[model samples]
Target: MIKTSTQNELIQYVYDELAKNASEQLETAFMHDEELAESCSELLQIQNLLDNALKSPHKRAVQNILNYSKSLSLQS
Candidate 1:
């Protein structure tokens, strides 16, 4: 069973947002806690899926943004 604090800390560690010392503590916890380790594995899979799904916008979207910005500049 993962406590809320441990879960939050692990999530931050996954995103590389945790402090160094805290991250080391979480790493040590992961080594000893099977549930925490499994939870980390699951979080990693979710992050991988999110990364694939949220890739940069398509070329058309980029072009549309650039065109809109250029139009705004011209208007000003």
Candidate 2:
């Protein structure tokens, strides 16, 4: 099993937040640890999926919200 600290470091590495020295150390570990490397690869794929996901609500949803607000304000 991977240590919690190592798992945290993997997350930091995936997010580009790990320090250079630590990042280098992790890379070295990857050379000898296929599971670690696979974990990193999976994290990268998840990050890419999240990055490409739609950011905004659909226009119809927004319009419905606005209309609801307008009706409430008019009733006030």
Candidate 3:
């Protein structure tokens, strides 16, 4: 069984977004807890899907910004 604290810590661990100590704790928990490991794996998949979705919108926004800057530079 995974402790509540360990399950909660998984949010950061899924993305490797935790500090060193917290990340280490997550790793230790995962090693000993099968349910937490499965949960973390699921969270990781969700994170990856979110990351992929964000990339397209981010690229579009960056391109828009670059186009706007180019237009402004031409005006000046």
Candidate number achieving the greatest TM-score relative to the actual structure? 1
List pairs with backbone clashes in candidate 2. Answer: none
lDDT of each: 0.92, 0.96, 0.80
Q: Please provide TM-scores, in order, for all candidate models, with all chains considered together.
A: 0.74, 0.71, 0.65
* CA shift of 26, model 1, Å: 1.0
Which stretches of candidate 1 lie above 4 Å from their native place? 67-76
The prediction achieving the highest lDDT against the true structure is 2
Q: Point out where model 2 deviates above 4 Å.
A: 56-76
Please give, for residues 36-58, the per-residue lDDT of candidate 1 as tens digits.
99999999999999998977779
lDDT of 2 by residue, 1-76 (tens): 8899999999999999999999999999999999999999999999999999959989999999999999999999
Q: Where's the lowest-lDDT run of ten residues in candidate 1?
A: 49-58
Tell me the alpha-carbon RMSD of every candidate.
2.2, 4.7, 3.4
